[model samples]
Target: MMEAANCSLRVNRLLLDPKFESYKLSLDPLPCYGVELDTAVAEVKLRDDQYTLDHMRAYGMYNYLHCNPWSPDSVFYVDQLGRVMNINVTLDTALGKPIEVFRFPSDLSSCDRRLCSSIHFTSQDWVTLSDGTGTLYLIHILRNDQSAAGKWELKFNQELGDPFIVLHSVLYTRSEVQIIDALILSIEKDELDVEGSGFHVSLEWISITCSPNDDKYEILKRRNLHGKSVPHYAAIEPDGNSLTIISYKPFRFIADETNQPEEERMEEEEKKGKEVRELFKMTFALPEGAGRAVLSSGSVEVTLAKREVGNMWAEVIAGDTQGEFVADPAQSAAIAERLMHLTSEDLNPNPDCEKPPCNAQELEECDMSLEDSTTLCRFDGNTTKATHVVNLGGNQFLFSLEAAPELMPCFSLRHDVDALMWQPVSSQGDNLWDHAATFNALGYVQASKQDKKFFTCAPNFSYAALCECVRRIFIYRQPTPVSTVLYNRKEGRHVGQVAKQQVASLESSDPILGFQASNERLFVLTTKKLFVIRVNTAG
Candidate 1:
């Protein structure tokens, strides 16, 4: 167990864009799109054009798309303050007003104020607008008082994503202001710092550090620091990767007044008057493949105190390439088991059989052997075949044939069926088809336990279907309804489901049109003039 005490903490923050491109934010493209705070009523669609400026009373903001004569497809809009801006281009806006032609800033052009690739208000006070040009602005909108107006300043180089702001809180104090971001927020501080300056995987060499001045306690009222109720400060690492700041007021403490000299009793008593700093030592093994599992080659060890005693607040920074660590239990165990299975030069039948200390050379050699071994089947595009090496009928009749392409052609699978109903394979329609490329990219196939081949497709000449795997295939069907079955090879069962219809264009009833599907919910592509279904699946 490593004790964390008197340690200097180095902090790092990681912000990632989780790709929330799908949810069509019902942000109205009309001039009066915002909610009227006094009335709580939102304006829907108002005509946005040059003629709109004529009725200045009706024009609250310009949120409509403008088509330039030269660039017919380019969308332009004037903001609430009547500053012209481009659509789909992230720009710095003041309360939905373009910064370029802001009412207050007459000297700066829209392009001069620095443009953001994406801009959205996290809150009235906390705004996260990014330019993706390596610059991020965290504008703190102060109160609307005469002194506080136009007092916004950038937090400076905080490469934050739009969604991650939900984890952050801006702390204002008499002395200092700080922003703490956490996936888990602690109302009451209870965390213990792990030992050492840097994270370690082994407990044999451990370093622990603790501080008496707790962050939670420091933020508490000045009166709270005067009594026995003052919070005990501790920092603990929950694992190799998380740092938890903990605060607690202990119920009781063991006093060791037996051996202290009478001369130093007063000094010792004064020290005892202060809050006790709780600390602990932690030990855990780094599970194999932990680092590799998440596409990260770094790991960290965090030690957390028992939760019953204190409230814990934690801040977690993800691993980078510099400090790559692996700790996934399953992956780690599999790796160790593989190592143990390999032949070793210093093999011992006693305690060594259970766990062996392997050298770099031995580990490398073992990895090479495993890498050389091939899977049951490898798809080869050049030959347009799924090369199978499985000895199903033993060595006597080893099945080594590529699936005959004509034996089964995939048309369309049922939305709620177990197998893909196939048809003749041909590139005969306006639709795109590639037998060699399609089959080669197929992910996996299920083997048949029964006499029936684990594949089937719908009979449709209008659509083309090519089997990627024995169970999975590409069914190119147009016109509206479509259905397909995705078989799980390991379970030897087919998943029946309808493909979602893609909204290619918008209807005349629905004026708004755009494409959104990064988050995997609803994918919609639209045009103001027409509605087209790009992807449709009928069950």
Candidate 2:
């Protein structure tokens, strides 16, 4: 157990000693969510020059603790030797011996275990790995399975898109367990083609018509818009065998809008070259889809999606208003069935949901004027669409940054400092997919003084761990009484709070590489040691 630290706050002139275990949330006097120092540490050292930081960093991206399906209680991780290590924190105090799961003469000579970087294409077992030489291999790994290939079996091998691509959401046929419908964006180059001073961008969508189980995937290159800039918010939609792009001229929130009058602002805006919010939607007949893995690839000016969403038409100018003409046949049967069902119900007036009158105060009246306000951010969306959303999901979500310190929303901006945010393309569609909305900052992570820290959250999200220097990790404990009302809150939502130099630090010898959080422990890997930090919230 860790001891409590004293925090001084000038609110209501009261002296309070918060155990630093939880936070008292209210904007005016938001409790400082402090840290718990090193109460316990045990050395579970590793073999020399075997499982280095590179292997740990690779495992950090594909942290399997959150996707433990084979063994509920045991945590699974891999080492440089291709050994699948399983650790049950409850049953064992330290990590046991390595369990060799690969087989020799497995027909995967080129994709050797030591040379390849293993990444899970799906949350479960299907892994499409790379040897970092632009070669991908399909492997089915199951530690507890009793199959022909046993734990590590190379199913099929093929040379696909860029090897250093991120992939997930494995697609399987509903009829049979066949892998199909995955999108691989193998970007040949990270930079746009520049002719002297011009930058050209291109996005190509190609769909595989057959199963990857046979392993004959194809690739096609799309055309590039040379010397032309893609419009803001432009996105591509994929149909059966083609692609569609939707874009618009945005009305960006001008930074110096405060200096212009409302009437003058409207008049000046009209003088611009193009009208604000100009809609542009078109189709590109490029194919889409992959076999199993949706590799982390291209997401720049172009976006690939299924259908058109978030398109708002002001008025319906033409037919289908009366609903007399049934144009499409596949929907006629479904439409008739729906009309028959609704025809039976009595005049179904909407239920009463009257909210109380606003008190005319700024807080209360602002609620009335919130015609376009939201509480949920993209990361907080339920199905997709939510406000600062009544304090994010039911379960605590952990967020990891490649090199931590550069990106935490940061603690505060006392008029002099600014905060930063890193938005990935995955959140663009999977989360809210708000094309028109500007990015919002609901919560924040207290940025460490050092900027190169590797960040990963605890399994339970009870706290967060960051490694900046060698052998030392700073701990940020999650504030308690998670509140949605940011009306003066000090800490960031979902981000654990820790002031500069006022948090717990775990020491080690070698450079700290990566971290994997489990229920009761956080597995900290160094150059040659695997240190376990026990997580406890109570003081």
Query: Which is the leading candidate under lDDT?
Result: 2
Cα error of candidate 1 at position 279, Å: 39
Compose the digit string of candidate 2's lDDT tens values, residues 301-387. Answer: 333332333344332335334312223475567679878955745465555747558435535221222112111121111111112
lDDT of each: 0.24, 0.33
Expressed as tens digits, the lDDT of each residue in 1-539 for candidate 1 is 01112221111112111221111112222111111111111122322331222122112221122322122112323233323333221111212321231121222123332221333333335433333222334445455644322344444333322211111122222224333211211111112323421211110101111111342221121000110121111111112121121111111111234422232465566756874454333333456876557645444546655433333323223343343343558757877888986766665656635454755565532122211211121122122122222211111100111122112212211111111222222233311112221111111112212221112112222222222212222233322222655555766866443222111112233323222111111112112221112222332
Give the poorly placed runs of model 1, Cα more than 4 Å off: 1-121, 130-136, 140-341, 344-500, 503-539
Residue 330: error of model 1 in Å? 34
> Which portions of model 2 show Cα errors greater than 4 Å?
1-92, 103-116, 142-150, 174-177, 180-445, 480-507, 536-539
How well does candidate 2 match the true structure, expressed as C-alpha RMSD? 23.2
